[model samples]
Target: MNTQPTHRPVALCALIFAFLITTAAADKPTNVVLILSDDQAWTDYGFMGHPDIKTPHLDQLARESAVFRRGYVPTALCRPSLVTLLTGHYASTHGVTGNDPSPKYAPRDSEVYNQRRAKLISYLDRFETVPEALGKLGYLSHQSGKLWEGSYQNCGFTHGMTRGFPEKGGRHGDDGLKIGREGMQPINEFLDLVKEEDKPFFIWYAPFLPHTPHNPPQRLMDKYSSPDRPITVAKYYAMCDWFDETCGQLLGMIDDKGMRDNTLVVYVTDNGWIQDPKKNGYAPRSKQTPYEGGIRTPIMYRLPGKIKPTERTELVSSIDIVPTILAAAGASIPRDLPGLNLMPNLTSGDPIERDTIYGESFAHDIADVDDPEASLLFRWAIQGNYKLLLTYDGEVNRYQSTHPRTEKRPQLFDLIADPTEQTNIAAEHPDIVKRLANKINAWYPVKKRKVLTTFQ
Candidate 1:
């Protein structure tokens, strides 16, 4: 036999090694980054066709994403909406229908309030959260900002900044709120650790930006402020710009780490906000109401070479987020989840099978921790071009003083014609109203529902 090895065997061995490396890379789990904008209107973004507000990074994201302009959360409040995103369950199903427990039950700073809050947080134990589900797949998750439901550990986050509720300065985010406002150090550190360990990561980056305190940098304020634009409006717009800058920083960091190709980024707003022209607060029909400005947001998912970028006008919900994420991760989706897996729609360009999406709006304060209907204010359904909002009898709560339900009737709008929801065509289209009302009832079957106006 010849001493020299055959060239054919050497070539075969090289090909085998290459094949193994490709397979391993393909099998690597994708990193997920959930970016939640707090209290941003659907129409405020540059990509969404706002006249003045500039969100360059988000516009870029929208271009790279499967943007759904008609996305709506089940509830139009921060806590419940965030809970829905985490669990893929509606506010009613998750039993966290409000931001806080009823103040009537206990004073805000009293031990009783803390106890009630603890009880409210306990509701999360009933369902599997996005982080909890991903944890089983060896994903290291970090909770950075706007976490209301107790600690990051309680929510299955491996590392996080929230100290949990009842802790000092722990109502919403606590120290976690510092992520975007102060700097990106916490997230940067977490990303570095993930790279070192060679493990998949999930980041919950729900910064309390563009929500309140409308205090942007002087440069941004100056850029937005004008003679016609009220100071309040200018401040709000500037806050949006600030939020976009933070998002740009985050995406840039990911790109710098060379992880953009393997990371899946999802963007959504917790709820919508319309700043008052004359005041420093949210205007009516937005934030805590069932109107479009309150409930609607531009939901986007960007995964390079995975999800095709396209604008979808069909109705989608925040409920679909968990299933979509799980499906992308090759994990088992819980059969009981009411939301649809959006992978097909996103990747294959298939239409969402369902024709209608439903939502429930509850009081700002939880009337009962166990009963979601106790705080139920409105149950709305969007079917095709028509939207039906059925008002229910419930406590308005102390917080809704600025914007209370003035019309105690079943309001129906042709969304195609009246996107602003200025006109109610319930009487004109009783048949459509009844059809949507029936659909809502079939979905929720609320026993405590006291409809202000019947469709008869």
Candidate 2:
């Protein structure tokens, strides 16, 4: 009887301690899932005022989330865009200016050596990413599909489901399965794997639909047959629907694991679609250009503890994402980050004051095409509604009477008045044009390489 009493007291104490530990863990750990869509146009989604795109899952997610109406990306293309998103740095610093010039596609060993001098530079893996930073805080980090600028795995992801899109000998095709097949596999697997584990986890899902090939499932492809819309519009709509289906599937898994309330679900696009001017009837420039259609993206925040179901028009860029995620999880924002923690805007009911947003790019055609090295310099800066595009098409020698060909280009736009970017108001608002030009020149130093231009 004496021995039994001693054992009972010890058992009660152990049980009490176990309960306290579990409660503490639950309070601190919060799962974060960032779903990144590839090159999706703003108007392609039904929620964003699209005429006829079936995005039920996206619509449902947005209905219960805070939407950022004026979200933008730092660059128009993939490699630079993803780098800026992870590091919160602009292209000039990150150095991933163009697509991956994979050596596998080199015509010959000598060709690789010859092209090395002119090869586009990519961002190194040393720059810390949100996932890696979260891992430092003892959070499990996992990513699938389109992780970073290059194959170097220094971004600090604990696990990767997919390396990226399926590339077979540099051949390009319209296979939807090839695009998102691997990136999504881990998302589905994690949904099931997390049923027992209560530890906080971070997962990134980048779907490759609606990007280029425009190849969606046949079932979704059958939904749109409007001849009035662009021929590619039907295919584009199909990709959007298919992407939404994946979102629904991921959400279902969250619900099944009973992690919806404790998880933060963020939906955003890598960049806007490469719209064709003749068909899209919206913008003149495509993805490789510094236009709103290429840079402006959609951002959806879904966290009951943080976000209110409302739309905010304040301009926010991709660089702000890392800080925002850290803030959401009660983690500290790193001192080196250029972005501000957005959790206050989401949770405190106070609006964030942002008057200016910046976007930049180097010539994209350099790597893929036989373009002149002199034309590879370009940049832009936007403040409020004013925008200035600076194109550096080689240097102009006074003796040769050479100058930038696009110097004849126009600037200045009242985004509120002409959101479509149709008319050039630079001549009418010379003051605004000069002001914007001066700001751009002040913000970015003029580069005098093989080419250079300063609009101011």
Residues 334-365 of candidate 2 have per-residue lDDT tens digits of 78776667778877768777667776665542
* Candidate 1 lDDT by residue in tens digits, 283-314: 88999888998999999999998899899978
TM-score of each: 0.96, 0.80
Q: In model 2, which runs have C-alpha deviations exceeding 4 angstroms?
A: 1-26, 101-122, 148-152, 164-184, 227-230, 274-284, 365-377, 394-410, 449-456
| lDDT of the candidates, in the order given | 0.89, 0.65
- Model 1, TM vs. native: 0.96
Off by over 4 Å in 1: 1-18, 453-456
Scanning candidate 1 in windows of ten residues, the lowest lDDT window is 396-405
Best by the TM-score measure: 1
lDDT of 1: 0.89
Candidate with the greatest lDDT versus the true structure:
1
